[model samples]
Target chain A: MTNTLTDYISGYMDTINQQLEQFVYSLQVPERLRDSMLYSIQAGGKRIRPILLLMACEAYGGSPNRALPVGCAVEMVHTYSLIHDDLPAMDNDDVRRGMPTNHKKFDDATAILAGDGLLTASFFAITNHDLLQDEEKVYLSRELSKASGAEGMVAGQMLDMEAENQELTVEKLEQIHKHKTGELLRFSAVAGAYIGGANQSQLQSIEKYARHLGLLFQVQDDILDIIGDEEEMGKPVGSDETNQKSTYPQLLGLQGAIDKRDYYANQAKEALKEAGVDSTLLEEFIDYIQHRKK
Target chain B: MTNTLTDYISGYMDTINQQLEQFVYSLQVPERLRDSMLYSIQAGGKRIRPILLLMACEAYGGSPNRALPVGCAVEMVHTYSLIHDDLPAMDNDDVRRGMPTNHKKFDDATAILAGDGLLTASFFAITNHDLLQDEEKVYLSRELSKASGAEGMVAGQMLDMEAENQELTVEKLEQIHKHKTGELLRFSAVAGAYIGGANQSQLQSIEKYARHLGLLFQVQDDILDIIGDEEEMGKPVGSDETNQKSTYPQLLGLQGAIDKRDYYANQAKEALKEAGVDSTLLEEFIDYIQHRKK
Candidate 1:
């Protein structure tokens, strides 16, 4: 199942990359703005969000191809958030995925517009998706908006920024992660399920699984920041500490954070089992999240 | 007709403002972020976009109440653009509508997130609008995404930024205004028509009227920057000159700019006439655009 999942994801990554490239190039935008947008997207990451969307769809007996455009839209949203998060006014990061951040490679104005362009384009992608019914498109877009909007990811970002350099409780940290990272990931999982026409019970099960998976992903990220190798992480360790950001490891301690990750991973697996769907690929993803170096 | 239109608009403004206030307060966002967003919305502008949307719908025999959510949504998009455009990296304006800009009132990070929150919330508003059919909602959302996305407003903004301090042709300036301001306004007009089930020709006519109206608004803004009162305009005059922005007055002189404004205003009236819909209020709007001091 692990090998099969890996093979499936590798192929899906190629498809997603191609779709994204085509979408960006298809835009009749100013050359520099287009280049700036493509630059960040082309600076690849793990492509985890799109992969989860596609895998969830496949698990529910839907064709991955049918869900490809939606998967690509989620990736675009994720990419836009990362671009904005790296802006000078935000995280001020100089590098992303080992390359210069968008604002670093391009001017700050161009980077900001690039983020705007990508975010706007995500909605356009969904509205123009060829296969989905209009009703389905509406549902998918609404879910995406809710996940990305103020009460969700953006709120979390605000909370995270406000929490910076301050001691945070476990509840505050959970709130931040849930909004900042968890909502979008949960949306990705449920969006695929929605596209696949999963039954209500299946939908709820996958959503629960995704919630745990999202927490696990963030916890492991905290652990990696403390203990992971720079070569594998593609960024320096101790960034959270440098930024004075409260993280799972900061709140729970390194070993305690590891325990939290393990706990969520187990919960995720259990939810997948209870979903009563094909769980092999999702289970493999859970394992990957638990063990990934970066 | 002018009296009737004025009364109608005043009433609509109250309703729209109330809806906007209620909508922002309904969100469970952090206090600072919510305050930042609400501050700009509450600061008050002409509310031109939402007015156009509601009026167009009313002209097409649709219930204004049915289009109220969409009107508010367009206003949110407009507000978000203003917030982002005022960022230090962009226009860097300290004041808007006689109030400190969002970034000045709140921090830069809060302003950016607030703008993002508003933009994302606009989509959520459309999807959550209960009165419209799902298909209508999809169409409205698609039209909005196109207007606000890369090929439209954001593209225009990039071009405008890139063209700063450079000599620009009248044609180039037209391109910039069309994308930067015209697209969203055009969307506002046609969106209402779409919701009202306007025929294809009506849609085209409203789109044309909106294009001219959009250009007229920008031209008048330029003229105001040159010759209008600082008190009424709510900011200092000649800021366009100060910023080295190529405005109508800069490119074509003050009288030339006024002539241009009249030309578009007349064109807008002509398009409205040709549309064969009730044009009383829309005509008044055109006149308002042409002759307003601010």
Candidate 2:
């Protein structure tokens, strides 16, 4: 099942990568800025956000190709956030995805503009997806915006920045994670279901699944940041500790964080069962999220 | 004619301002960021881009209300650019429109996120506009994307940044200005006319008019940067000089820049005549672009 999930995800990513190249090729970005956006986005990663959206759509009986635009859009939003996060003004990271971060390769201005360009372009990609009906296209575009904007990812980022060096209660930390990482992840599943024309009950199930999956995903990240090897993660470990950011590991002890991750992963699996999604791919997804080394 | 244009433009602005306020209110941006976005956006500048769109639609025999979304969209895109341009990595300006810039009022990260949220939200707003048919809405969204993306505003900005302190010819300067300031302006007229369901020939005429009007608008802006009073302009005088950026007044003599503005204005007026648009509002627009003081 794990192998099957890997094969399915890799296939979807290849297709998505091709489409991304085509979409970006149509734009005549300055060579410098273009290279910067391409460097960060094109550097290989798991492509989990887009894959989740595709899988969610397929689970709802929609063609993955039909949901490709939303897939691309979620990835674009994720990429833009990563680019901005790596900027000196933000997280100030020097490496990402085993390569120099965008700001490291390009000047600060080009990196900033590249992030801006990618962020703006996500809507263009979603709205321009030719397969969806006009109304459906509009709906998905709005959903995508809601996921990325002030009430969502941006708000989450603000909380993360503010919470640095300050002790945060569990509730405050959960709210921050929910917005920062969970909103986009939730949107990935929900938008896929929406674009795939899932009914209300099915959507609710997918939403439930996505919510816990997101929490589990972040908790795993917290664990990895604290103890994972730098080579496997492709960056220095313990930077989170050095930065004094609030994390599951910090809020809960290491063992407590692992326990919470298991609870959320179990909840995620239960939600999928409630949704009646029959794919073995989903079970494999649960296993992968919980046990991945990187 | 200029007085007539001012009246027409201001009336359109008054209506659009209400919609702009509603959009900002709907964002539920954190109170601080909301204030930051609203501060510069609501600050009193002529709503030239949006009003131009409405006038063009009106000239093409469409209802001005039908163009409202497009009007507001261009303004949103314009406002986003302003917000980002004032960031510490870019112009690093402390003020705009007689108030502290978004970054100055809020922190740099919030300002960046606000600009990004606004940028992404523009397409969402265009897609969600209730007035247009599904097809028209799709087309309008596509056009806005083309105008705002890397080949348009983003690319234009890159060129502008790269040209600073470099010897830029008139042609390079025109290319930069066209993408930076003119693409959105051109899209305003073109999009409004398209929404009005203009025939192909009429669309062509409006496109020509928009092209000339957009360049004329920039030429006048360049002129004002050199000679306009700081009180009226709401920024320091000779900012282009202060920034060591290239501009029309630098490439051409002051008289030459003035002559070029008049030439483009005349061409704009001629295009409207060729389109056989009976809009007195559009006729006056040419005059305003040619000689307005602020």
Candidate 3:
């Protein structure tokens, strides 16, 4: 299952990079600004968000290749968020994915504009797409905005920032992750399902599946922050604890948090079954996330 | 001409404010984040861009009220730019429209999220419109993203940032304003005419009118920064000079810049006539921007 999923992702990785590169470079913006944006896009993210979008679309009987641009658009949104979050005014991280952060490599001003450029370009990738129908563009734009905007990821971030130094209940932490991280994952699956023309029942089930997967992703992140390798993880660990930010392990004991990650995994499996998504690729994702080393 | 336009603007001001207020408060975002967003929205900048949109729509026989939500959406985008520009990494301004800048009123983290929230919400405002068709939404979204995104306003800001302490020719200065300030203004007119169902020729003419009007607006802004009263302008004058930022007034003589503003105003009027837009309100906008105190 893992090999099947890896092959699927590897097959599309080149296409994804090419399309994103061509798109960003094709823009008529100033050279320096364009370079900053391109730099972040070329940075080594796991590419999990976009790969999930393609797999979901494939599961819904849509050609995954056709969904490439949309997947790249999601990656842009993801990249933009990371760029903004790493700003000195925000999380202030100097490293990302083992390389200098956007603000570190480029100046903060350029990083800010680069983030802005990527964000605005995400919508352009959709609305100006030659292959997508206007209705699809409309629906995708609406969903993307809702998921990424104040109503979703941004709201969740605000909640997380405020949660620092204060004790948050497990339920409160879940709520934050559901909005901050979950919405985009939800968007990935839902968007893929939508682009593939899934029925309402299937869309609902995929939503459930993605929601669980999102929490699973966050829990693993908290766990890794405590126990992961510094070289493989690309940055120092325990920064969250240093910041005194509450996490699943802090609220739930380490064992309890591990138990919770398993519970969400089971829920996700159940939802996937209910949705009739029998793709080995998606199943591989579940297994991969649970046991991922980095 | 002035009174008619003033009446037209006053008639719609309350509606615009109410709609923005209602839409923002109704969001399920965190309270502090919501308050930060609302603070900037409620900040007292003249609603010139939105009013221009409504007037353009009305000139084409569409009801001004029908265009109000879209206008508010543009306002959100405008407000977001101001917020981001005022960030310490950007313009580092402390005051905007007689009050603390968004980063000044709230912390930088809150300010960044607030800007992101507003930027995302602006799209939702258009895509979720009760009165718009999917095709209309699609076209509007494409234009809005291009106008506000990297291809337009963001690119312009980057150009301006790079221009600091660099000698800029008149052509270079116009190029920056065209993207920075001009793109959104261009969107306002083009979107209004589009919503009003103007012919292709009419839309093109509106685009031309808007292009000139945009440059005219910037030239006046530059002139005001030099000669305008401080209290009325709500900030210190000569800040542009203090920054050593190039402007039309600096590149051209003060009187030369004023003359150039008048030239664009006349060009705007000619395009308006060609578009067959007979609105006294739009004509008055040309006069208003030319002599605006702020």
For residue B127, model 3's alpha carbon misses the true position, in angstroms, by 0.6
Candidate scoring better on DockQ of 1 and 3: 3
Clashes of 1: 0
Error of 3 at B85 (Å): 0.4
lDDT of 2 by residue, B1-294 (tens): 566776776666678999887888888666776776677668757888888888778777788878887788789889989888878788789978778888877788777777877777787687777778877877777778778887789888888888888988999998998899889988998888887778889888988898898899999999999889899777887888888988888888899999999999889888888886776888788887787788
lDDT string, candidate 3, B22-43, tens digits: 9999888999999999999999
Cα lDDT of model 2 by residue, A92-186, tens digit: 88888678888888877888888888877777787678788888777777777787887789778777877889999878988888888999989
Question: How do these models rank on lDDT, best leading?
Answer: 1, 3, 2
* Model 1 chain B: ten consecutive residues of lowest lDDT: B1-10
State model 1's lDDT: 0.90
Question: Model 3: how many Å of interface RMSD?
Answer: 0.8
Give the interface RMSD values of the models in order: 0.8, 1.6, 0.8
**Which docking category, incorrect, acceptable, medium or high, applies to candidate 1?**
high
TM-score of the A-chain for all models: 0.98, 0.96, 0.97
Q: Which residue ranges in model 2 land beyond 4 Å of their true spot?
A: none
- Candidate 3 at residue A45, lDDT? 73
Compute DockQ for each candidate against the true complex: 0.83, 0.65, 0.86
Q: Name the better of 1 and 2 by DockQ.
A: 1
In angstroms, give how far residue B102 of model 2 lies from its true place.
1.6
